[model samples]
Target chain A: MVNEVIDINEAVRAYIAQIEGLRAEIGRLDATIATLRQSLATLKSLKTLGEGKTVLVPVGSIAQVEMKVEKMDKVVVSVGQNISAELEYEEALKYIEDEIKKLLTFRLVLEQAIAELYAKIEDLIAEAQQTSEEEKAEEEENEEKAE
Target chain B: MELPPQIQAQLMQLQQLQQQLQMILMQKQSVETELKECKKALEELEKSSSDEVYKLVGGLFVKRKKEDVKKELEEKVETLELRVKTLEKQEEKLQSRLKELQEKIQKMIPTAQ
Candidate 1:
């Protein structure tokens, strides 16, 4: 019985550890999602720029260089895998929106996995309680018979 | 009472297996991320209107043919897919082994009652 209790405790400990790790992963995903959303918003705001519009480009956090917007209809964006492509403004918006959608879907999957782990933990706790209660009842019965 | 040597050894082995599983999970996550990036790049490449694309090589943008970049990304995606599959198999195996060891230890220990 003692070993059984120990085993249950160990299982609970392991579950808790896993939950912690998963929670950390979810936190990272949330951060990434937030960053992507911010980028999306920023890109949308760029629509205000007109062709040949003068703007200040920040240089290494020290000085800003004045530059003319040669074209506002298209922008260069880093798609991924160290590759950048020239995409029209509308296309860039679509790309960012797609990324956000994918991340949201991934986050939902993680949330579901966490819920399943929580359910398993609850079941284990209930089993541990039942085991201990049965042991206690048996002990009390033995004591009464001896008396 | 002290735990028997056999049980102690099993517990140690279980701990090591748990660590290995955690490592595998981390690797799987990283690989999956890379795969996602590759897929995203491919999608963008297909949708792009430009005849030529720029690939970042050693902090420099080297202009390349669109087909060449697309082929490179496709190969990367294939390799990453294989890695993810192998890691998943290892994870499944380790999980089952852990469960078996736990059950074995539970059965080996005599019930106090």
Candidate 2:
């Protein structure tokens, strides 16, 4: 009986450790989400900048040099593997929106996987508890018989 | 070990869950790091106002027009934003599930005196 309890205890400890690991992942994801949101906001602000507008551009360090935007309608967009193309402003925006949609789809798949894992964890915890309680009851019955 | 079949099955399930969780966490970490780098690069691009911008392609920086670079950065940022939202949703779902499991475990196990 003692050995059985110990075995269950060890399993419980392992389960808890895994749960903690998942928690740590969630924390990291939260931080990443914050950074991504900030980046999005910064990008949106760029839309307000007009063509031929004078702005301070940063060099290698913190220092900035004044520069003028020649054309805002056309932008060179990176397709992948170091290849880029000259595209109209609207076309470039559409390309990015499509990429975002793809990411959203990927994220949905990930979320589904996480949900499935959570369900499995719940089932395991419930099973462990049931096993533990049964063992406890058996132990009590054995003690009563001895008495 | 002479364990009941039910207990053995439960143990096996727990082990499987542990492995799955580890794999998922590894993937999550990689995605998070990639998003971080993308955000940093976008920030640097935003700070620079020069008409000429350099993009790193295949381990080499190629000079490109500033407008093009900005558009690329904006698209990257937007894509990352959607990704981050999805991650947040997953986090919330996991958190609630964890809480439920903890409560169930507490009920099953006797507290240490």
Give the number of the best model, judged by lDDT: 1
TM-score of each: 0.68, 0.47
In Å, residue A6's CA in model 2 sits off its true spot by 7.4
Write one digit per residue (lDDT tens) for candidate 1, span A1-147: 889889988988888898888889889988988988887775665557765777787888989999887766776778889998888888887877887898789888888888888898899889989999999999999999999
Stretches off by above 4 angstroms in model 1 are: A52-68, B1-40, B74-113
The alpha-carbon lDDT assigned to residue B109 of candidate 1 equals: 81
Kindly provide the TM-score of model 1 when superposed on the true structure, using C-alpha atoms.
0.68
Could you give candidate 2's per-residue lDDT for residues A1-147 as a string of tens digits?
A: 557557666766676666666666666655655554554454455557766678887887989999887676665655542435555666666655655565556556655656666676677667777887998899899999999
**Fraction of reference contacts reproduced per prediction?**
0.82, 0.07
TM-score of chain B of 1: 0.93
Report lDDT (CA) for all predictions: 0.87, 0.62
Candidate 2 stretches greater than 4 Å from native: A1-47, B1-113
